[model samples]
Target: MFASITGADKELLSCITRLPSFFWEGNWAEEIHLTICPIPSLQDGNDLTVTRDNTGCRIEYRLPVHLFRGLGLLKEHAEEKNFFINQKMYIPEIGIMTDVSRNSVPSPEFLQSLLDRMALMGLNCLILYMEDVYEIEGEPRFGYMRGGYTREQLRSIDDYAAGYGIRIVASIQVLGHMEKVLRFPEYAGLRDSSSCLLAGSEETEQFICKMLSSIGSCLRSRQIIVGMDETHGLGEGRYRVLNGRRPPIEIYLEHLNRVHALAGRYGLNIAFYSDMLFKYGSEKHTYLDPHMQLDEKTKELIPSDAQLIYWDYYSREASLLNDMLACHRSIGPTVYAGPLLSVSSFCVQYEATWKTAGPALMAVKRQKIPMVYGCLWHDDGAECSDWLGLPGMQYYAEHAYTEGVVDPGSLDSRFLACTGLDAGWFRDAALLDEIPCINPENRWPPNPCKYILWQDPLEGLYDADIRGLSLDLHYRRTAQLLRRDLEEAGENGAFLRVPLALAEVLEIKSALSGALSWHYREHDMTALQQDAAALSELYVRVKKLRRLHREQWMSSCSPFGWSRLDLRYGGLLARLETASDRLQDYLEGRLSELPELAVPRYTLDRCGDLLGNGIWKVYDKSVSLSDG
Candidate 1:
């Protein structure tokens, strides 16, 4: 297929030509020509129109993304073989922030694919949230052995993003969320808490300078997000010994201003998560405090140009989101961040994600906020492929691009045209967590598949909570559905394979414990034999899933930190074998009954409805319960 691009520079033309072949497959024209002519009447860089005839398709767009959007329309209406489109974009910065810090930094090739997809959806920004996964000069301990990207690598990615009119913003930690950096002996002097840096320390000041200099030297975008959210025990550790029992607000503001000053040295615009501010301001010490008050001194201390970002991933009401938006705007220049709910366990929580993002996006638009991005935060392991967020990204784009309300039909057509997959298939993957659906909107995002797949079958922690849920049927059906979709998944089969493999494991495992407990108490030899056979089948299935997961990890992420998941899968496989042996002994009457069966099962004792978000982890993800 011959392709000709006009109104785009040689660089951009090269970038577009290199896009995956499927991007242009729908064009039936023998000589496909795309011309991005400027339309003075159109909104600057936000409005575009495409017209097609026998000669070629002329797309008049002010911005590169708008041009791609025009091309997107071409493919969307390809079956018509002739069409015209005029679209005016709503939000200027429809972007995504992918967590590179949480043990899953995307490979450059995958990053390029990410850029290609974002551009197709007319997105104009990508924020890489690198807590310690980015190269910093003279800071060997910063991202050492963490698969951090080199300076050249960042520059290359930024250049690629620029071709599609997308900016690459650097999201790194300057205050808290630095456990990876501060854990080393070399950087211990800067530590105040386990994850936070010492406030008002001379050494910490110098470290901020190095961070700014190193990061600013690489990323093309002037915007930088220095995470200052959740600086728990802010003044309690070494900071208290030095600064003496000062308020968290004092320590946080002082350190943030210092970071703001250092950022200015590199001409970098700074933004930080604003939760700590609200947490400190209100008597309740929570972000949702409607009565949240910042003292005059606190308000005066805020940097005029700095942006305070409000991030929410678990709200369904637009009114609640609007109130939070109001609270954030009262403090300072505000940016909004919502979630794709692709964190923790092994799947995207679409019910939580879809419900929350809709209201959040509506609230942002209602306030006429120009910039908003969806956060794909891999808080625990990032094992759930962030690639699954494609549907969420498309949902975000359609909401931002369409004025007022989004047309569902348009969303489906555009997403299919942009990604070459039905949006429904990815939404179906959410069934991995949606089974045994309890609370409304899956607000807690019960990720039972994660715990079920790893928990020892003999000593199932959640066995009582799952007794009546019929989860085995749910998982079996989910696996059956995804297996069919995997055949049509094409090159993107890896993404579908991950959830499909998980569902296959969960189908057997969800019910295995009930069967084991039943047979052991009854001492039925016939059922004991069946249990042994089931465990044997489970061991093979688990091994296959582990191998598939490893491939999924290697294909998209950095090589480092994979051992964490590998070791976890290894332990599960080992436990499965042990369970099989114990069952064999019980069948032979060597052991009277499995000891675990004699012990009465109990519901999640203290945690109740929210027991680790349905994921079993030794280190609880709470400030009080947190070990890691």
Candidate 2:
């Protein structure tokens, strides 16, 4: 009963201390709970009431103000306060939730492993974007089956996360983003073609509402993010098929209203992206005025109680963040600001975006905004896992929420060393090995160390079948060269160049392997053998180059080493275990008497055995929640 505490909002809980308390509480083993979102303000909190029934914490909170309570603040005093709070001290609770859109949902053991790793890195939440993964009517999961999370399975995640003090935020796509559903046969008739929405009739509204109410009621979290971003298809004649005519926003507003109304019924505070209001330009979308000047129309459309998440990750400009703080202050004190935490750009360029974001976060903090969330907008979750996985994300998460600042390279090295991955990269290309290979596009220039370096490989072999070789070669080669150049780079030192170069190499390798696999079947042993042989030869050369030019490589890529292979390997291992069961079917003569002769039964069996045994050896190497 976290919401029962009155005046809890004013408590001014330090980000530092709260993390310790969170971990201590989680360790009790009796009750497991994790904070997913920002702690906002601790003051003015409703008194929370929880019984010792051995279940997790139950929470409820009242909306402090009505829709227009802060309307006055929007006009007169919008620009005075900053948008970010305690920028220096804010260590954000980051997460890596598997977006099961294109693939099947991970098993409970897989999730447990994931949660365990998240906890180690101080990640406090796991938000499963359900719509893209699960099957549902009207909201067909594109490129995959449209299924749903079982109640028991959902509860397992909830309970597991609670033990590590991590909250699971249920992300459901609603309103205009329902393209997947609209395109499905069963839901096609319900869509408003002219308006490109599902709100032309009562049936559609009921259908949408049922999802929110059902998921909200069952998720067990106080917050639910109703995804309403990228509604570009709205009002493009999709709605004209149903209604005579209607603007996209009108349909959106109607759906939003319905969803908002239902969210209140189940005691959940709803969060939505603030893109639609700003999509029509600063003038057309007055709610977007960097100065917080809201036009009449904007005021009319925006709900007074709805929590707006202003997502700005790329732009270093603070005007937008500043304007939000000002306008929200004039309106009332309910506005919340969260900057998207982007690690790819920073990792490749070695140019800290936070340097630009830091001041903005400070602005939000100064404005008395309750909390800030760091968004990891991974387009393809599996691919992006390597780009900004747990270690990399955790580094940024720590810096985002805390006052301490760390170099990306240092953090990478630290994580590698701490996780015992730094040493493991040489033996095997671990996820840590991918850290140096990140080829983040460098938007900043003039300073090479400020960015990663990508050069034409002097020599190398390419392989598509063997997974880690490309990344391994990329790091080994890039580290060799960058280490040499750092000596003359001066002031920027190794800091600027090493990370960028490493990132670029990683990107290149990942793309190359993905390309080869996509085009050729991995089971083609002849092709795989050719690629592997070439890669092996290249790997040897790169190793030789490093040894020969050890000083140069070390100097340039000063912070290098290790593999956190165990991180993602856990999931892979889980798959192998399942595969082994299938193999047992063959061994026990339970099904297929013969293994696919075309497929190497020996190789497949060996691969499966290796992975199954590997997972067992590193079973304890998972993380669940951030200290905060």
Which candidate number would show the highest lDDT if scored against the true structure? 1
Best by TM-score: 1
Instruction: Estimate the TM-score of every prediction.
Output: 0.94, 0.52
What lDDT score is found at residue 457 in candidate 2? 18
- Candidate lDDT (C-alpha), each: 0.79, 0.43
Q: Give model 1's TM-score versus the native structure.
A: 0.94
Q: Residue 100 lDDT in model 2? A: 39
Cα deviation at 565, candidate 2, in Å, is 20
lDDT (tens digit, per residue) of candidate 1 on 20-47:
6777674553466767686656754448
Cα deviation at 274, candidate 2, in Å, is: 0.3
* Decoy 2 TM-score against native: 0.52
Mind giving the per-residue lDDT tens digits that candidate 2 earns over 498-595?
23343334444333333334323334435544444443443343333223333322332111110122222333334324433543454355754323
The C-alpha stretches of model 1 lying farther than 4 A from their native spots are: 1-4, 26-33, 40-46, 53-55, 407-410, 605-628
